[model samples]
Target: MNRRSLLAIAASAACLLSMGLAHAADQDTLAAIREAKTIRVALEFGRPPWGFKDDKLKMSGSDMEAAELLASDLGVKLEIVEVTGPNRIPFLQTRKADVVLSTFSITPERLKVIDFSAPYASAVQIVGAPKSLPLKSEADLKGKRVGVTRATTGDVELTKKAKDFGVEVVRFDDESTNMTALASGQVDIVIQEPATLTAVAARNPQRQLEPKFIFTQFPVGIGLRKNDPALKSYLDQWVKTHMADGKLNAIYRKYHGTDLPAEIVKPTN
Candidate 1:
């Protein structure tokens, strides 16, 4: 064979080996967690009532509670990593976190890049404005400034139809900062999931940002890397198992003042 032919053959063989190694790496990932007795979870502290740190510097909320339980069930200790809107997936890709338990929405486009657990909760996109600002419909946002978290479903959807939605969209790093901007009148309104934004408003009783959430609804799930297919499947079944035992409902009721529907709560386990 010529020199070029020899190099091509070697490159092809290396590519096959790399694919095999990738598979082993996934198994190795699961094995390392199972053996080490620890799992790392990502959280966006800016989203209160789902995940956040308190005055004592201890993490708390529905997501933290669920993560701790998940780790315990997996026979491991919980390791928490703080993440923001921009870094949540990067943290997973870079091996900084095993799962993203933040309020993540699962979409077909995102599924191409990341795997998702069973739908844990449904979060609807909503518009929040000062009571003084009337917003009966999305079209009312025209000529107004709407704040959203960067790269979120709310941002993607609103930005896609910014013209039809009738607003100039201003994306922010996270919800807490976005809400602050809206409350200060820097933005006319904030776009976010209704339940999450409600919890945020409740947490800050004195500082309220009135919201009229616009979209219908979408289910939220935990995010994991696409490379770890088996891990993703395991997480889906894990969530389904929790749902079967009513543990998931109990968790949501404890934090969000509501219970998941039978359709959404069924254990795929």
Candidate 2:
């Protein structure tokens, strides 16, 4: 090429490099974790095999195990924060956590605000039907009462489709109330993610709450702030590497085979 052309190309390259750095520069979420050598992740401590403390008061579960690996890969120590469905996104937005390593799902609407890693697991939606309820099919649920956690996708799905399914919907603020209302016949069924319900059933084996109906299935992913693509990539790569090597499956099997928990493994898309 000519000397003038080479000079122009070099000048353009310098400008582009500066713009890229401005955009990709680590945010506070990653910077703090990098400096401290620990990734602070949000988890739902209420559920076992995810984040609930063990008998010795230690964070124990597949999510906990998974996040621990992720921290190590980033060359950092681990810091965990407890979070729930509603607050998961807000926590990432405010940099409360570097990434929500909890069982967060990827949704189109949510992606407008938070970027998500590639899915790690599928979050299946199912129902807990009491034997007394004659909910043999979707048709039988007509005019019947159903309970779901407030602000959860289960709530959105049931509320939108209830009238057509011949059901009325009631939402509870917490999982305890949702399950309790269903057991008492106040609601015909309670809707929740299959993994969580699996954990619940394991905790209360004395009561058999069969999942009679499954309505929706979606992949679970880590949530990150819009600009935090670096963190998203870190999580995605970690999941991919471990899953391919069978480490993820081994963890799932160990917990799933015991009273500690069972998993509702969602179909990966």
RMSD of each: 3.1, 6.1
Clashing pairs in 2: 37-76, 37-77, 142-166, 143-166
Q: How accurate is candidate 2 locally (lDDT)?
A: 0.71
Encode model 1's per-residue lDDT on 61-144: one tens digit a residue.
Answer: 788888888898888988889889888888988889888998788887788877888898766678876666778887777788
Candidate 2 residue lDDT tens string, 125-155: 7877645555556677677778887756777
Please give the lDDT score at residue 92 for candidate 2. Answer: 75
Task: Give Cα distance to truth, residue 33, candidate 2, Å.
Answer: 2.3
- Worst window of 10 by summed lDDT in candidate 1: 207-216
Task: Point out the worst 10-residue segment of candidate 2 by lDDT.
Answer: 258-267
Q: Which candidate ranks first by TM-score, i.e. highest? A: 1
| Distance from true location, Cα of 152 in model 2, Å | 2.6
